[model samples]
Target: MQEERRVVFIGKIPSRMTRSELRHRFSVFGDIEECTLHFRSEGDNYGFVTYRYAEEAFAAIESGHKLRRPDEQPFDLCFGGRRQFCRRNYADLDSNREDFDPAPVKSKFDSLDFDTLLRQAQRSLRR
Candidate 1:
């Protein structure tokens, strides 16, 4: 199966989190290719994050599905986060974004399979 390596968070991010924090939080799944948070003068804010592998993207989605407090509201997470069409109409909007920069406070991910990670990283570099 060809797993999609992208995810989009629709609506406002919980606690008004910025793209920098978003990157840090999601990086635990894997190396992120890009993370973007766009602001709009009207309507809800949206974020786009792309992971290096399908598994990483899936992990991020799974993490977002966890239980949370009633008062806590997170962006609606979904697969297939392409923004090509959305970008065309965003010239007037102010966007907060980053290209895989893990912010000032680095996020430490839990241990992963080193050999598998290494192989995947190398394959990505080639492609």
Candidate 2:
């Protein structure tokens, strides 16, 4: 069996950087399977770039690739991990369920029972 290629995590990306710009930069190394950009609350951004082959991923790392932006410091690149980045599988949860009935969501206060409303009011008063 062959080793699986992992997604590469590039950190300290600029918020102004576009997805196309990122894709173009990494494409030179190999065929990128998937790419994602994550913007943080602190104003800095980060991203993940996954190559189709392990050899391509290794080439990128050995080359010490960096995202070079005009008038800004180059953003460094590194190997993320073999684990699929930020992806979740919910198929198992859905498959195990026989029924899909979900609880009704109530929006209007008038839809609630009178006794339930009174209890809520009492709880608010205690707070």
Candidate 3:
């Protein structure tokens, strides 16, 4: 059976760091498919990174991922899994209570009678 992979969430990556550098550091643990550096239209930076496999992704999480120069102090790092990937952490499971069910979704189809719609349309045209 194919191994289930986890999607790791990484934050606090350095703003000035290049993609190549990010790949090199992360590749030491596993294959990295992509690395994106988010930036606001106003030019402020937000740190984010995604990994190809769960094992390497976990290593990165344990490495105390931070937004800093190699010799600098480490910043806060947050690593979590994606729901689609079937990855769940302790915190994720704990937050949801069994007694609290979400509201039933509304149907997508229009339930109003056609005659009512036609009358509304006619009234708008007359106005």
Candidate 4:
């Protein structure tokens, strides 16, 4: 069986942090397949960041997975199983709870190739 390439991040998501920031933080280790932050409550929340390779995941685990920005709190990290989660789970799990789930902050640049992006940029300049 293929090993799961995911690491569970246990910590509180700072009010300013977004999924893209979290994903970028892990990219140094390897290519990230997906990064989802489950913002449960105010005190503590959890998220799963899946890498493209088990070795990448292992590297992250070995490094202690300590993420530190100049102005953010460190998250507790560990190897966790690959469990699929959905956005609806938030509502289903607790309807009354107020959770601040930040949307994934990916720019159009992330999806566009350089040529396509350059064309769009030129088009914009022409207008």
Candidate 5:
């Protein structure tokens, strides 16, 4: 099986940082497939840099490359796994009751009668 591409999570990133700047900074370590910065309105912003090769991602972490600005403290870096990134944290999971169950999703199409569906399709065509 092919090895999965590596992603590095950078925490405490400045909200003003741009994709180009991140790409330039990590490019020295290896070819970067993508760089994404997640900006939050009420919390600290973070970013993820994906490398084309897994070795390059490991090297970048091992080298201790810090993302710092002229007068700001350096940002922290760590290897990010897909599961860790996607899964909810312990605190969030624990807040919910053990018996909690999400309501079944109902599709709009399923609830609409044939006449309503036909009218909606006609209205869409008019636009």
Candidate 6:
């Protein structure tokens, strides 16, 4: 079987969370080749994150947290593909970053019930 390419989606990170900061946070799980932190306006503060591998991506997704904003709404999580990797574009490393929106945060997700997700991932991984 092929090694699954993991693509995790971390949305609604505090607008204050910088790309560097996000990289640091996620890096705790595993190696993160690249990370982009999206921003809304100057300080509206909402965006998404993506990781390179599946295990690291999954670990990040499992660690749930409420948005740092006043409303403190919970956001969704998942993974996606790196555009450059698909195109085999070795020349334009920055192209992928350009396509990534660091603001508004991805809206769609597997509900906000993190407990359910944790149980599911834990159960599935054990098998």
Highest-scoring model, lDDT: 5
| Rank ordering of all candidates by lDDT, starting from the highest | 5, 2, 4, 1, 6, 3
State the displacement of the C-alpha of residue 51, model 5, in Å, after optimal TM-score superposition. Answer: 0.5
Tens digits of lDDT, candidate 4, 77-98: 7777434343234333334546
Cα-based lDDT for every prediction: 0.66, 0.72, 0.58, 0.68, 0.74, 0.59
RMSD of each: 19.7, 11.5, 14.8, 18.6, 15.7, 16.5
Q: Candidate 2 versus the native: TM-score? A: 0.56
After superposing candidate 2 on the true structure, give the runs of residues whose Cα lies further than 4 Å from its correct spot.
1-3, 64-66, 85-127
When 2 and 3 are scored with TM-score, the better candidate is 2
User: What range of 10 consecutive residues in model 1 has the weakest lDDT sum?
Assistant: 87-96
Q: Using TM-score, give the best candidate's number.
A: 5
Query: Taking the tens digit of each residue's C-alpha lDDT, what string does model 5 give over 1-127?
Result: 2245488887777777787887788778898887888777765777888888999988777764454667655777788646544446433442336876656789979988999999999999999
> TM-score for model 4?
0.54
Any runs in candidate 1 off by more than 4 Å, and if so which?
1-3, 67-71, 83-127
**Candidates arranged by TM-score, highest first:** 5, 2, 4, 1, 6, 3
9-118: candidate 3 lDDT, tens digit per residue = 54544566666776676677677766665544454444445666767767777774543467644644455434444544323443436775555677643677889888
CA-RMSD of model 6: 16.5
TM-score of each: 0.51, 0.56, 0.46, 0.54, 0.58, 0.47
- Residue-wise C-alpha lDDT for candidate 2, range 39-93, written one tens digit per residue: 8778667788888897887777666345475676666667875344336642334
* Model with the higher TM-score, candidate 1 or 5: 5
- On lDDT, the stronger of 1 and 4 is 4
Each model's backbone clash number: 0, 0, 0, 0, 0, 8
**Alpha-carbon runs more than 4 Å astray in model 4:** 64-66, 82-127
Q: Relative to the unseen true structure, what is the Cα RMSD of model 4?
A: 18.6
Residue-wise lDDT of candidate 1 within 22-110, one digit each (tens)? Answer: 78877877888888887675646667777878777787777854523466565577775544546364342334554435436543433
